[model samples]
Target: MRETAYWLINIACAIVILVLLGVHMGVMHLDAILARLVGTVPEPLAWENMVNRGKSTTQVVLYIVLLGTALFHGFYGLRTMLLEFFSSDRAARVITAGCVTAGGVLFVTGTAVTVVFALNGAG
Candidate 1:
């Protein structure tokens, strides 16, 4: 059951990413098409309040999941890819560990910063 739950979370994460990818593509294409049609180029949207925006509750949840999953997936991928490509002995393992550790620190620090910003309404 636990394994299934974890698998589901992974699948959900992938699905979330896939959804974001599609949304991104659609927005890019739409922007270009709209620019041509409207004869006015739209400015790129900027995100303020890096922690808590006026976004929906669902968006907040998705943001957290996206942050966590992307960090884990990308970092782990980099580590494994490096381990495969580099045939060095201690140096490679040390580098892999270092990469993972850096990724972990990034995730933790980022999350903490966002959480503080979120709770304090300073975002």
Candidate 2:
């Protein structure tokens, strides 16, 4: 039952990652296409545009969410693979602990940076 729940959560995280990463790519990498289609700014990565986005609460929240979701999805996937390869209860425990700890640290750090950037208005 516990494993099942974890698997389900992992799957959900993957879906969230796909959506968030797609948005990130479109906004940061497809500036030309978006500008042509919707008359957006020609350079999404321009300093002014970046500062604007960094100052936006919505963008900050989305960035945090994306960071967390990506970390959870990646760490869970890595844990699954390590467990399968090791196939021991002790290995399972160690792998799970390591992944959880690393993921938590990364999430906290990323969230802190995002919040700080937002507060500083990307200046």
Candidate 3:
């Protein structure tokens, strides 16, 4: 049950991240730039307007979620692979646990950076 839940969550987060990246790129490049070129109103990129009007909040949250989920999934899955290849008669689970801990630390740091930007209204 728990493992299935994790897999489902991993897949969901990957899909969300992929969609968010696509939408963000499309807006910044296709929509926003085209709007500017056609409208020709003297203004900056107007990212603030993009955020205020467009679905910027979802993009920001999705970015963090994507990073966290990918880190956890990739590192833990890699650790599992390593366990299958190597390890003594024991210590397999221990090593995987260590990887999980390390991945958790990395994800926390990454998430903290994302939080700083989100809170400061950068992203």
Query: Which candidate number has the best TM-score?
Result: 2
How does each model score on TM-score? 0.53, 0.90, 0.59
3-118 per-residue lDDT for model 1 (tens digits): 36645665676777788766555444566776776787544353553233524455445556667877766765666677787869886769667876987898787767655655
**What is candidate 2's CA lDDT for residue 13?**
87
Runs in model 2 deviating more than 4 A are none
Candidate 1: TM-score? 0.53
User: In order, what is each prediction's RMSD in angstroms?
Assistant: 6.5, 1.5, 5.0
lDDT of 2 by residue, 1-123 (tens): 989998998899899989988988888998788788888564786888888898899999898988888898899889988988998998999999999999999999899988998888655
Error of 2 at 100 (Å): 0.7
The regions of model 1 sitting more than 4 angstroms off are: 1-13, 20-58
Native RMSD of candidate 1 (Å) = 6.5
- Ranked by TM-score, the better of candidates 1 and 3 is 3
TM-score of 2: 0.90
Best by lDDT: 2
Show where candidate 3 strays beyond 4 Å.
1-8, 28-56, 87-89, 121-123
Clashing pairs in 2: none
Q: Which window of 10 residues has the lowest lDDT sum in candidate 3? A: 50-59
